[model samples]
Target chain A: MAGTVPLSRRNILTDRRRLVISVLGVAVSIGLILLLEGLWGGLRVQVSSYEENVGANLFVGEKGVRNFLGEVSAFDSSAVDELRRRPEVKAAWPVNTRFIVLDFHDRKQAAVLVGSVPGGMGGPWKIAEGRPVEADDEVVIDRALARQHGVGLGETFEILGRRFRVVGLSSGTRAWMLGYMFVSHDASAGLLRSPGTASFILVDSEDPAATARAVREELGLQPLSPDTVAENDRRLFAGIFGGPLNLMVIIAFAAGTLIIALAVYSMTVERLREYGIVKAMGARRGRIFRIMLGQTTALAALGFVVGFGFYLAASALITYALPQFWSHVSPAVVAGVALAAGLMGFIAAFVPARRVSRLDPASVYRG
Target chain B: MDDVAIRAERLEKVFGEGDVQVRAVRGIDLEVVRGQVALIMGPSGSGKTTLLSMLGAMLRPTSGKVELDGVDLARLPESRLPDFRATRFGFVFQDFNLLSSLSALENVQFALNLAGTTGRKSRERAEALLRGFGLGHRLSFRPEKLSGGEKQRVAISRALANEPSVILADEPTANLDSKIGHEIARLLRNAATEEGRSVVIVSHDTRLKDIADRVLWLEDGEFREINEMAVDPVCGMAVERKPETPHYQYEGQTYYFCSPEDRDEFAAEPTKFIPDRG
Candidate 1:
């Protein structure tokens, strides 16, 4: 009986080209999956992070609210005072959200207009430039929209064909459906032609459940906690973009798996004679299969490294081009991509390895 | 009696069935002892190669028994055949089926690896074998880079890597030039005689008669004793004859031929041939 030949590291490493190609295929597939997943995850995180920082204890809105961004809820302005009078409510304020077209430097751009009272709980914006919105005819624009429209502080911009002064620049705040502009209560009403009407009411209360109960009883309006508001935002986003993103991820995974499978299958077929010779030399079927799998795994590992590096460069390019669009390169995402790539390579090599193992040495030798 | 390294009893191989059936080997009974080179010679379709395959335990007989060293090969499972071939018998093909992807040394080492020999020892053994075959400098060259004779030599080294009890050569020298062919024959003969291994060669080349201890002539799926004159008809051409001789009188002339068919050929044209009275 002949003894077994232990696997050689030198042979495996020296055959770097095959290993690199296989790894690259796996890595590209996994990196694509990770990119898609990370993009989706980053969007979710941005949305939730924005909502959490808003400091809203409860949100008053219309029943069956579908689009929360820049949509009118038709709550009376007097309801704010009535809700604030409740025992559990510490403060209540009216919020006006509407869409308006802006004209700056002869360029027209559409923007979501948000209105809040001066010195109120939701009034002071996190300004990125210039001063906060204080005057009735003054507004603050998001940095992205500001740069796009070439508008600066103290510059007057026309909204809905009415001119208003640009008071400041704000950051980390955007409407769900459109780029945003922050304005005083009077200016927002003028833009919408609706006085004493707002989209929703924001409450700052220590106990949200109690305040929500109070608002429901006194004002006959449903009060939603910030968490519920975030949840609604998530549900809305998912309804609009969830199906396509999920399908994209699934298709990406499937494509990656198929690519790896084809690569491995072709490689196995090419090396069929070599495999037969090895088997004839007394290599057990299991060992041959393992060597093939190792080859695939090694290739996939190389691909993952290259793909991740490519993904990082691509993400950076995207971030540089569109600063507002979040494109994160997370280690977890890289690792997830690597794992997925490895698995794809493993699965892809499986059928071919089995075919190789089951091949008759006698027949191959005859051929 | 010495133990038979390979023994086949009434071996039969039939291909297909019904009208399309072809009986490859009718019934072959033979015994090969250790340290002897046996040659099976016949024209194509004479079941010479088929018999060799059956004896090497590479193919199963249709209705017969084959035993190697007292182990019944006919009853052995299909899965066990590879192990048996790897450990008990080595094979040399005419085309020198060396793997093109592997260097000559690696090709030999691959065989050692399959036999579960690994590490520095496998390399050392492979190097020794290659050096012994005078291929020390050609170890790194792949099959495509090597000459035909070198490839055949590497193949021979691979076959002998596991130190099997028997070596089966199927027209081993058919693809080589006369010089290389003779060299391969000498190597095979040396393996049998000096290394104490049984060698079974299937070839139509009668030049191998000198190296073979016994020559079995297969014709139409049956083995027949070959007359030395029949192997090489020209007199004094290093022919080895059987003890008995059969002669035929044609047109008042005595004709000497090996088989009945040769005698019939002579009968067809009696005046064109002279009688061999010796």
Candidate 2:
């Protein structure tokens, strides 16, 4: 069209200061949503990391035990021996896992305490420094937790009123709010007061499917694969934290929509005279609406670009400053955010477009 | 082709309802032939703007009809009105109304674009129009950068961009000094005379009468005979002579005032406000 000026672009660019402020407002809201979603993604991965990498083919728990967190499971220690005797099961070992709060220098830190037999299937897969737990008094804690609490090798921390020396600093062992603390089976048995029972029996077998079926039928206990156990752990974590995280994301989205609405509405109101002039010059309501939508979409897209950049920097800073939080920004997460921004743009354009539509074209003559 | 470019028959506009109804334009008949400049002069509360708006198809008449190019504008569907206005009528506003965001050339091109003209053709046409208006040197300047005269010239260029058959102007010279105001009036007149487009202007500026082929004086939503109306020497507002109207005898001529304040102001210094006497 001959008169198809880039009115939206020109209007937004007219006031550089206002445009920057509007973009930043939207960027902040978008950044917050991205951060929350990334944190949620990271949490899902971290919650199940240990079980996924524990090297056990299957996990034998109490009949009703669903996951390690928020669920208690303990079976007779004799079950481990019975499982090892089966030809389908190559080996079996008892492992006890529970939540415990450690007090170091009068500061309390929550952690998932894991105890297994020396050189067993269930242990810290990767040690960043020091050595694994070998003695009842020795413990391997997450490197992030150890560094956070200023605990080093040979330093003692009180767990369940018992003192234990830090033996190793394990890598990738911290969840968002909790870290992993590894100790000996005897030590965990003593700490949890279940010396004759195992929380779970770790099974190693070449024919894991046959062994799992045999264990379920003969042993009469719930046996789950490592992958199933890890997935259950993830579901448990999501069930606990999903509501709050989703609520925060929704609040961020609403804030972003309002920011776009405020900016576009104000711009439309300020340029109402020009709109009237255009209407008088034979520009239709549809054309005026297009101009408003153009401005809104431009604002949202710019904010998204800026917000994505902000998320990258902020996520890196969070990981560097507080190593416990792992923020993962995936392509799907970014695409979801882009779709949300587009929705925000459309919703924000409504109020301003309606206002322009109701205006009288003849009002231009009043000037 | 119709020699009468615009013919309005008993146009009426009533705002509000019942007791609060405002008859903005009432039972006014008007006609403008091709190449004619018709000026509608009135006081502040008169219906000149309303009539002009109706004539330009910007506002629907409460009753009666406005005919342009042998088609009754009031009968056209709402959806078709914008295109009709874009291709058949040009509007010049008191404030120039050039989009502040667009350059002088782009402002003109915007009109062509609205009329389904685009690309290089629109650009060349817009450029030629601006250059004809002596704004060739300021093609890229936004509205705020242009002087008042330059802005009005740009507005005129935009009005002429779609090659409309009729030009509807509301107070086109209200913001300019006498020199520039006369120049703008002459431009509108030339647009009518040289291009054979009929021009209808609603303004209080008496200077526009110099180029107007027909001058209509409106008061209280109705057009009165121009000879029966007096221009207030103080504010240049058209005032109808009535028993209660503010009147003063000045040099053997009876002058009517829209208000006593204007009458008092004029009574104090008749000579000072008498140069543009009507």
Q: Residues B1-278, candidate 1, lDDT per residue (tens digit)?
A: 46688888999999898999999899889888998999988756788777877777767899999988888889998778767877787878777777666688888887877666777788899999999999999989978799888988998999898898888887787667779878888998989888888999887677788799998888789997665444323221122344444456655745444555655665666545553532
DockQ for each candidate?
Answer: 0.23, 0.65
Residue-wise C-alpha lDDT for candidate 2, range A1-367, written one tens digit per residue: 2246788899999989999999999999899999999999999889988777887889889998878666788889898888888887778989999987767678888899999887886789999999898899999999988888788988887889899998899998876679999999999999999988999998888899888888789888888888888889888888899999999999999999999999999988999998988888888888887888899999999999999988999999998888889998789989999999999998999989999899899888775
CAPRI-style class, candidate 1: incorrect
Best model per DockQ: 2
* Model 2 docking grade: medium
**Candidate 2: deviation at residue A293, Å?**
1.0
Q: Candidate 1 lDDT, tens digit per residue, A1-367?
A: 2343323232345456765665666667666776667666666655554347656778887655534552457767888877777777778778787766656677666666778888775653477888878888888888767776667888886777777888888876654324667788877777777798877888888788887776677667777767777777677767777899789877877777776666667766776766666665556666776766766666667666777776677667755566556655467766776677778668766877788877766553354
Q: Please give, for residues B146-183, the per-residue lDDT of candidate 2 as tens digits.
A: 99999999999988888899999988998798799989
Candidate 1: the clashing residue pairs are A2-B115, A3-B115, A3-B116, A3-B117, A4-B116, A23-A299, A23-A300, A23-A303, A24-A303, A281-B114
Candidate 1, position A147, lDDT: 71
Q: How does each model score on lDDT?
A: 0.72, 0.89
TM-score per candidate, in order?
A: 0.79, 0.94
Best prediction by TM-score: 2
